[model samples]
Target: MQGFWDCMSLWKLLLKGKKGCHVSSCRVRRLMKKKLPQAWRKSAVDLEDCLKQERSLYKQAKHTYAAQWRKDFLTVQTKDAKKHQWKSRKARDRFFRLQQMKQREEARHRCCAQSKGSTGDLQAIQIEEHLSDGTTSLRTITDRRLVEDGCMQETRHAMIKHERRHSPVHLQVSKDDHVYFWPRNPENKGSKPHGLHNGHFKAAIQSPSIAYCDALFRNIPLTTGFVPLQWQNLMNFAIKKKPGDFRLSKMRTIQLMNSEAQANNKKAGRAAMQFAEAHSLIPDGQCGSCKRHQAIDLALSKQLVWDLLILQRRAAGWISNDAKSCFDWVAIVTMLLFGLTWHVLSSMFNMLSFATRRICTGFGDSKRSFCPPSAVPFQGCGQGNGAAPHLDLGDTVHHSGEDICASVQAAATLWLGGIRATGGAINPEKSFWWLIDFEWDARNGQWRFCRKCSAAPEFDLKIPGLYSDIEPLRRLEPDDSERTLGVMLSPLENHNAQEAQLVSKGLGVPHLFGKQVYKHLEMILRHMLGGTKPGAYMDANLQAHQLETGTSFGLLQQDYQNTSILASDTWLKRVWKELESLDMYVAFDSPALSLRWHHDALLIDLFIDLEVDQDDLLWLNWCRMFLQVATVSDITTADGRYIRQCIWNGFRDDTYRTPYNWPRTVRPGRPYWELWQRTLSRALLPSHGQHHPLLQPLGHWHDNFESWNWLWSPTVGLFHREGAAWTHLALAGSSTISRRYAPSGSHSGTDSLQ
Candidate 1:
């Protein structure tokens, strides 16, 4: 019996020794596997000899490990080659796309020019003829030899004007308005030159040695408040205004100063803007050069006001006035006086004033003519001056009185009188006043123009310098849109006009729809595939579809259909295989098989619905979703119940209330399910509160709870919880929480519960 025990122990010891030997051999094999490939790459060797040595040491079959190693190496090589090929293909496609875009832009420009006719050329001829006429000619000479003499005379006059002015009040430069001699970007070519081009100055400023010399030159003028004679001289060019009649009056002049002078002018302009803003000198209504407000903001506000007036069945009047040669006619002395009153730094104003101009016609340099300060009625603020727009005077008046026309006329008269008092005059021909009113047409179910309530009266505006006799204000028709401060104002709905304008710019509805579809699909596919391979595939498919169907809408529809089928089938097969692997019985014909496919289909469909749907009440869907989720009562899970309570608490504590009265304003024509689906898709964004910690867990159960109470609740049930969950999961990841929607307290509470 003792001998038997000893033999058993010896057998166990032998087994242990074999196991250790196996482990040590594995460790050595792993090291060789890692090192051999690197060694083989570095130096050429006999593969047969290496395999023979490996076989002798490990007692392995011939070519077993070597064959596997070679397979892996070839696999890596093939993958690298394919990756390089894809990169080159992507770059090639990008180049072609850009070239095509450039061609489209050029074609659009040509088409626009053809449609507009030769008005620009005709206006140019008229301006030249007008300027050349002896009676009204601005040219002082016709000979090239007399150019130097004219320039000398102009310089003498500028010096005289400077000497005659009263001494300026000195003010210290603020840190906010400190002037920096920063170099202009090298890419900005074709700069209009006055003796020295901007490029030369830009290059000089980039060099340390030359930059020091330029700084000294710039500092001398800033210190003394005296611009050099050459810098004061300007070259003027005439440009025809678009949508204007072929006449000299429709032409505008742009002046180009020396590059160094321009740099100083830019600095002065920036300082002047800062000073004006600090003092609140500019009125809120003057949106042209203000930083706080934009011209678009004023336009949108006016549009909103008009809509409100229409809704209330009220009438309003507006008087819009434009100054003739607004920048050209601004009085230098008057600007200086205002600057003093406003406490602006006198050196900045001095740098802007005391300039002479020489007109450059298409033929030559205005026949050696120079416009001196004494010859021009009001000098200094030219069209190209950096601070010219701020100095140019303009005004708009809105009146809601019963007698709107009379109110507008009174306002216009007072405003024009004030403007004339300041040595500025309004162009009577360009100024206009029009009444706006709209009535609901029950037959068409939309607002229509009220001819009787809205009338643009032809009343004479009696202002002294503007007109010798009373001249009638031109009435703008209801259909006609007016451009004011770079914003287009129309009596009709501006959105339609804006849409038409965007369409003209190649951003039509179909184009936008396709772009959005591509964007959403690319996002989903990228998440699913875990790479950019899906995006490349989708782009290739889109290009193919674009070729197959030339029309934009047709191409979008075809691409969407193809992508839906391909993505749905691919995801369905993947999910089915995964289920089968888990030993879950899901028949091919089972209803459960369609859940993922349906989710993907509905997701894309909802995206399309939002893009194309023009219903005014479409925005209310998000509010409906939030309200429904807040009032849900059937959630059984702890997290689900907590989410509901938190949502309810949010509604109770906050001022935001459910839009219960929306139905009274707009009766939705679509069914509740379709609306719910649309809302689910729209609210997928994290900003809409979809990424809350409580909401993230629900996404995992979306496939299981299709028939949940929320899905069927038309009034206050959580019937599309799964849809909302999936949407949130698809847009924002399943585990990711929205920092914006999830409060710190809620996140901590949820974490503790979990």
Candidate 2:
């Protein structure tokens, strides 16, 4: 029946004589139009083309008739002739519209048919056609089903879904995992590196009674979060049992556990040795000074041991003199209350750590190992991420030794108040000790303590140069570097007399960059030769990742879909491996780089003299690769394709601005330096994303700005410039080089250093 209606519609087009079809027939045609497309598909033969031909013929006939009518009407000159002409014109326009509708419908039907028969993939096929008139046409066959603007985006996203699912860098994070990477037992294959590896960070320091022990020995106030009940009982017991000299003698005995017992008490030292051996504090076979030192260290860590020792010291009449010299009860009480007050206030507003350059030591420095152990989850003081608490006693203004001790303890306790407020506890795996010694200067008739802080050359080492007559003091003992608070009064160390100095603090600008380059080379070498462990990946959980990727890439962990995952590409890893095995280290003979401080907070402030070998291709190539790899960072995007580019160009110079004075590469080697210079030129310095760029500073201000300063503005954009400013204090201190190495202006003309 639908086919019959379709045939009737075709007939209606042929028989133009009929002004209108019957109402019942039109109703049947409308109903058939809905149902007959599939049924007539096999029989369809381009009826719309036939209709076009018929319409053209009708228009030709009409024009002829109109011409004759006009000839006839030329004599008539009547309004009726004009009226008939208007009617004809209206009929012609209506037919043209109907023809266009039919053509469009037929084209749509043909497209749908072609789509159904297609067996190829969804890839767009580009069609190019050359015309005789020397023109070409291009057409892309796309999925018409998803051709809408929004749907096309959805289609693109689906293609890379597998890559996103299979990514290894974004592994699932857990509550137990420390926010920062920490070392775990390499032996325990099953255990994750959650900061809880045994011998990594012990849990004994978390005990409440240690506060009382610290209070007794150092007269320090109790930590902010410690429960008062535990302290009250421990204090009561210490007061009731005044063991006096007996306790001191016992500690002396325990201190010499490995030595043979005296004739008067033959079993004492042997029994102590047996206990130390059982606890694995000392090696079973070793029985000497080393074993005794280890046992003393282990014993001092225990609260019960401390309590017993305190009683013995009280009995020996030594506690009173020691307490009088160091303990300031009034100050201790004041600071204890101050910590508790801050603890209460921190509930509303998070307590913040102090911001200063001196306190910028990162917990992740491999050599210093300042970070607390894995077991102690450092939530960080209220100061935000990358900021560490300042525990340097020299920062205190107090002059008296006892007052200084009291102030340092108070500061530590108060800092802990903030830590405790956020559910973090100290890890006592290793004691953190501060060695204080005063040297008597006969020239000035005063005693002074030397604090060798790492600062600029202007503030060099605090050597006692004033007292020339002062003799060499005793050397620091092996046990002096212990972590916990143990007051050992000893003379100043004869630092110059010893073959090896106790402190190896890198000083001045030269040592700073030399150490940095050395370290970077070492790290690259180590990773390349040995191949870093597969799972040694840093977590990118910064909120900026989500914000920049529009929340598509986020913290939510998905099941990995790929067969394998890698933190770095194979080429990168291979490059490092090759560099590691390179015997170029021996061939690289160059003068040491010299650096001097100029007191500018930015790289522009300092100057460096680097000796580069222009003739050595190996050195040039190494420098190029090192600079490229060091500065090239992969921008985080939803798609995994690496858009590797230099992220530090904001700190370098460009054509418009000769701000950063990067070292000049000469003649043939100029290309290497030029390429590096171009990479650094990627970012516009001080970009405000505003219309007028003229307002921003140029030249020296642009080049020497403290781009790495912790308090520096985020707009300078040495690294990440898109979202919130990344404020890692350590990054600011060590991430830049002296301006002399990176001199401004072109070195295009000559090869000489001058």
Candidate 3:
């Protein structure tokens, strides 16, 4: 037994020593005294000293091993990086080669198809010649050759004249000190380089060599006002407008330009844009290319006008015109004339006008055989030019009352003349006009479309250049909605009903009982747990807690114990049973008469006392309306809760205040919150039971203005102690707020009234 104890002590010391621990002689001696007899005490001290020596030797070996490991790791990393770089370069080369091969195949296919058709015609001619006399056949061939020679001579003469017209001297480029090379940040300009040499832009900023080369190439065209003939080469192709649409009219033509040409165009376009903006050449109605103006802005403006016209019971006309090939038909000569008239820089116009396009059908087509004349009298801005959109000319007109037809005719005539002057035309087939008028229908108890008062039955409006009569547009009845510029305009009465229907479908609840229960659950989750945390996080936590306890985090059990109403209700039991089968975590609060589902974070609080009957169906419609408003507001669950909190606080204390600790409280201003409160109060309070505090209208709260003495103001400094500063504050603040909320006012309406 004594020997066994001694061996265990030795084994423990050996293990500790191997782990690089210093085994003290005194500590070993004390352990040995308890584990071994008095006879082994002296030997234990010697054993501890030996173990200490081994540990030091082991640590030295470890340090040497670690150093070697790090050295090898760095060497491997370098080799890997070199290998990756080589692979990337090889892949890029392969990609370019494949692209070239594909282009060659497409060109060959087109050539073969043309050749086959021509061969059939030639064979027929040869057969006819064989049947006819030899002399006549020879004479016919000779005549064809002579005509071809004359055509070639004419083409050569035309080329010479074109080259002379585009020469530097003709364009007036004599300045030697002109600095046309302005370096621009590619990132800021959103310039994405694509072509055979696109890789040059990848390291353009990092590598001085590439940047210098790009600058050198870009300067030549800007300085001389003559693009290099080779750079003018373009490949034209057609892409389908949609996946399965093969109609010729539905195809879009695309022109591909090299990276160098693209870069030059971008610089010239930016210059032109700046010039237009500085001169205010672009009209207010032209929102297509204007900064800070969007399609939605135009749509909202039109909608507002329509609404006003409808409200005033006035007849109005709307004309929608589309230009046929707006970018492609505008002549280069017209562009130059406009530029000169606008007093644009002579060099800029020279560069833009003189740059001719020679396009081929395929990228692999030979420049001499497939490409056309350098100066083909190009019309419109080439589709791919950056400055094309900025130069585009169009107009929108609005007129009301009896002179609507005359107004339309005059506007159309004026617009067409301007378009023709710019070498552009409108497509009458694609253009449409709408006659809008509303009248109160006593039979239907709502305002309805009055076609009789809107336009004459035999009215025929026409513009000379269009060569077709303008058609009256009608509202689509299939969907009960009319869409213009992607905004859906539905009848006022049906809009709310449609929203309610959509909400009912989304919840997947056909019965009033299920809907009522779900609504209560959604309310509690949105107002309580949803505000403090994200839906995903709360769902996961609740799910985990439910799984662990098998009782929905004690909520169900607590509800079962607290009240007999929920426990005894058969409908509530059925809902619970159905919920358990679903892939969701559900909890019920008997006191609040609320239920919550974990997955979607759906909480519905009936907002009724436990004694009140939960079977009422009258309030269900109002609940749906409130939910629809919240959804239409496009607010997240957390934001909805925060907005509700703001409203509740405002109603209770007559002061709207949100929790300072709330993460997103500072995002929405007082007006935004009040707007939401007003909207929600209108939606819920009108039909909802008066028992809940939220069912009462939230009147205007007292404006609790706090004086910020320490905060710095951009215009008035730390504190506005002077009268001049206060006056400036009043004017500037009002202007800023009005500007900020102008767009918001356009968006706020009865669109989500349901």
Candidate 4:
């Protein structure tokens, strides 16, 4: 029947005297209007050619026919012309679109079919095989056909309700329904996100007493949609038993199997880790010390916005923060939440800027691998098809030492591309944390530091006077097909674009080029022998891969797709700038750029600098690779392409923006610094003396400019004891020299002479 219709159409075309019907073979005639194409390349070319032919025909018809002839032509050939025009589209596209739609409909039908069995289905997916004292172990039947999104909203509500009911405690949440924080584990391999509360956070501090805990439990007010009673009892009993001092001293004992203790204790852990692979645990979370509390307080100083009006409104350009102390928890939470709240409200109003979807994965207290968005079924966060916005919680206040383990573990969710941030990033279960964004006023040189923070710098290993004249370096955008050892500029353009949209609380001059905002960052690659690049750098895909997945390009392809899954790609830019500003490669043989101290937030505010031990520097390259993958991130689009260039600058000469001046509380014993040092030591140190080459001089002998020792004590004082550790350092106090020689042995200056 369709062939007959096709023949009829062809007859109509022939009677109307179609011009392009010259091919005579039956097969050719049959396929003349078929317009079938195979590959993407062919389809693209065919589409272009078809458009051109159509244009030529239109032009020819306009001039070739008289007005009366044109009327007759239109009347005689209307249907044929329409059919031919439709045929101009490649058949492959029509087929592909039909296939895509079929796939979508099939997927939807499959979901509906599966959902039929999930709601009150009582399906025995995971059967509880072992019930240890504090743990419940289960083995689940693999049913790939189960659609996560269609698993019934009531099922989730039931889980939450059952868990809360068992506990018999809940805080009435404001109808605002806070957005949960969903940070990722390095790979999608660790524990998933879970809810956190008082005992949950305090476990890391001191074990709760039966009386205090019991009283606290009794007193915990119940609220709607909170943890159910069953899980509450499970948690209460598990934590009620005292676990001895697992403070900073417990860092070494990662796994727990106490043969000396009760069987109940063992069972509790089994239950927690075995509930589902998605379960993440929140160990005791408390500020272990006064200093830690202060640190946490400082990090979490930003204030939360009270209402949706100020909390949710995105602009087109120029989102700035100028208060000196405004970059606190409230600010970060505000930044994420305000953006997200606006997003949610926008969704409510049907006003999303683009076709972004809702994240719907439920992260539980288990391995971080299950930390996926609860909204989208397959892919989680980023605008692209892979992961989502890796919004990491960086506020000092949020870094409670005793609670970090708990917080990182319990509150860890997969916040794909900052999408699941309706209630702001902070778990609204408590009031101590907030994730907001602030700004830095470049023109006036002011920073919006967090308002509620009162903590002072915990450690300040001052190494004053540095490259004061290192001019401000604007991040240049990577040209097509070329990547280099400098700050990429597209980040800046994207940053500007995002600031306008309230997608980010950016620094620099945040401006939107179009609807998309570029990311602005600073970069400086080592660009030397033994470095990872040239090969790594030239592979534009590699750079993009790392920039997106926050992991190695090689690792990314093997592990996941759509790799923009890091917390903050901007941090990578900062590393690049530091290298460029220091001119790390060339030994300062000439009149050198001044050597001084730097105290950016990455240093003092976070205490990452004090942590690098002498042995860990060798793996610094690898460490950087890991950390960049873990921390920094960029924004891309749905089809796996960057919307704009991230502009990276090499140097910035702003006096107020002193990358050198540091906070005072960045000493060895400080919590974060110590933790980083320990991490570096563990990563770099070996049992045999065969340490990595970078590690050798972290303290004693290497000449790398960015070494822990060099960055900390850049210049050993001239007047100090002559034979001290500082004295043995290369060109100890010389501003222009970087050669190796023992301290001038001829010098006989005595301390008494001074």
Which pairs clash in model 1? Answer: 710-718, 710-719, 711-719
Which consecutive 10 residues in model 3 have the weakest lDDT in total?
A: 657-666
lDDT of 4 by residue, 78-105 (tens): 7566533354233444465456545655
lDDT of 2 by residue, 68-99 (tens): 76577766776455533435443564466456
Positional deviation of 559 in candidate 3, in angstroms?
37
Candidate 4 off by > 4 Å: 1-102, 118-122, 129-592, 595-754
Clash number for every model?
3, 21, 10, 163
RMSD of 2: 41.5
Instruction: Tell me the TM-score of model 4.
Output: 0.19
Q: How does model 4 fare in lDDT? A: 0.26
* Candidate with maximal lDDT: 1
Rank order (by lDDT, best first): 1, 3, 2, 4
Question: How displaced is residue 41 in candidate 4, in Å?
Answer: 61
What is candidate 1's lDDT per residue for 1-754, written digit by digit as tens? 2223333333333334444543343543344454432432321234344444543544342235657766888899888784334354435644664565456557777876887543321121111114444554445453333443454355435444553233433333332222234444332422344476766766665566676667666556665666577776667777788655546646777877666666655555655556565666666545566554556545544554454344333566656777766676665555442233222323334434555666777677754645442322234466776667666531122223334656666777787777766556776545665566554343333445555333443343344335333445545545456666554676564446555655566654556645644544444344235423333333333332222222222223333322222221122223333433444432111111122211122222333445534332222332232232222222213233123333322222222322221111122233533554345435332333433322223222333343332222223212123223411112222344541122112111212221
CA error at residue 190 for candidate 2, angstroms: 52
> What's the residue-level lDDT of 463 in candidate 1?
44
TM-score, structure 2 vs. true: 0.17
Q: Model 3 over residues 1-754: C-alpha lDDT tens digits? A: 3334444566466556656789876766766666544534335456566556655655665667767867888899888784324344435644664565456557777876878642222222121123344443322332333434443344334433442211121111122211223233233222222234444454463555555665665566665545565554455556686678977667776555655565555555555555565665666555566565566545534543443343334455566667778877755443332232212222333333444334344354435524322222335555665566766651112223344656656776787777767556666544556555444443322335555334454555565333332333322221243444544443232355445655755756578556756754563365345342223333333332232212223333334322222221122233344444443445533222112211111111222221223322112212222232212111122212223433322322222222111100012234433443444444334433333233323233221212111123354322222221221122233564453211111121122211
Winner by TM-score between candidate 4 and candidate 3: 3
